[model samples]
Target: MTGDHYFSAQPSTAIQRRDVEFTVAGRDYELTAAGGVFSASRLDPGTAVLLRKADLPPAGAAGPFLDLGCGYGPIACVLAAVAPRATVYAVDVNARARELAAENAARVGAGDRVRVVAPDEVPDEVSFAQLWSNPPIRIGKDELHVMLQRWLPRLAPDGVAWLVVAKHLGGDSLQRWLGDEGWRVERHASQKGYRVFRVTR
Candidate 1:
């Protein structure tokens, strides 16, 4: 064992890959997971809620969607699968996660559509039609705020961001904070102790 967090850029833990299977929107996914990435064992409860509750991009949606803090490309793969014409960017700080994300993207037959990259590699000039995240809340509020500050403004004028945070993990407070920051925030849904927020500029 090592003192490694999922957010670590290079996790030192031994990689023991596992298979994760789940269904969303009548679609099934079989992706790889490994130690040292977020939700390595199963689809995270919060992410499950986020995907189930948030509005998925409609078919024919031409997107440059952002899957912020994408762990193993679940959101990215699903978005690519659903919005076949879109470009899905899966950003992660962890190298192993990025590797798995790319592999999973290929596995889902979306290798050509998904761009799995490090956070810094995303170009600044490009804006997103949608951003979906089960953000890294454990990274602390200050860091999380910095991340949001950096990315939220990249939303296109008519774009939307769907976020899921556990209520006990400052979900309500984050919504209030987003409102204070001048973005429109709506409580889209609440399920299993998770708060789904639909945000717009």
Candidate 2:
């Protein structure tokens, strides 16, 4: 198996640590990344696009938000920093990614607000007020759709989700699919060949 695939639940490669720094919504972040994680060397372009394009949570926004497929906790940390009253859940399948995300959260002093966990570890009763993701599109269309189906429903009735996908990676098709699935999907932004989608129930 390739060591570069972020969707590997247990990456079969040695962890070689590095630093990844980026700015989102005027806030700066320097997080730890490793060989086995997603965007192990830098802030992924899709993630940067998503952060820049989506409507971030208001400072007064409260309660839980979800960073689905959180790699090293970029989105989760941003949400926690922006919405101090909220709790951010950083969910990932890769163990190495989860570890790095937790460490990054602590580094940002949002450790108290960022909860890094495996997908199934999230409490069944907890529903999210907002969801953010730069999904693992390489997992193939079927698996990607399954992942979205599993979590998108957990959004509260008034909640919204922000997603970024590369235009060549079926971004438009995904938007249509979400609409067909009964979501109110909006093409919020298109930048650098990436499509940012805003989805609501």
Candidate 3:
């Protein structure tokens, strides 16, 4: 196995691409996945739980949504599919992942609406109405905290962020940390050893 993690900005390993299929809210999705990206083989169970438990935005929900740490655009595609009016931003540090995300977005006929980009590429002035993520928890606590600190502030006053974390991977502690950091964190759901959090200011 390669030493590279999905979070690597420029994965130095060979790229082996494939399709990952899953259904959310009775809607089917088959997104492109590849080596060096998060959950390349299947829809991650945590992500499945997140999509299943967290309240999805209404069909008429406005634009400017975020899919933080988008792995080949599954979440972004689903968001765009469900909320046709929303402009979904799919952000990832991995270049290969970003490329596949863009392609997957196009395949889903959401190319015009979903913006696949690196984290730094997102405009500083833009705030999101909703943020969804299956965070990169294995990146280490310090880095994970920094990542949250950086993005959570970009939520609009009434915006909400949904996150799925493995229970054994400090999910409870992370919720506590977010609470200590002054955001209201609710355990929206727990299933298959994962904790889904609904966060808001």
User: Per-residue lDDT tens digits of candidate 3, residues 1-201?
Assistant: 468899999987778888898999998888889998998999998888999999999999975999999989889999999999999999999999999999999998999999999999999999999999999999899999999999999999999999999989999999999999999999989999999999999
lDDT of each: 0.95, 0.92, 0.94
Q: Judged by lDDT against the true structure, how good is candidate 2?
A: 0.92
Write the residue-wise lDDT of candidate 2 on 30-106 in tens digits.
98999888889999999999999899989999869999999888889899988988899999999989999999999
Q: Candidate 3 clash total?
A: 0
**What is the lDDT, from 0 to 100, of the residue 169 in candidate 3?**
96
Candidate 1 lDDT tens digits, 1-201: 359898999998899999999999999999999999999999999999999999999979989999999999899999999998999999999999999999999999999989999988998898999999999999999999999999999999999999999999999999999999999999999999999999999
The collision pairs in model 2 are none
TM-score, one value per model: 0.98, 0.97, 0.97
RMSD of 1: 1.2
Scored by TM-score, the top model is: 1
Worst 10 residues of 1 by lDDT: 1-10
Residue 42 of model 2, lDDT score: 91
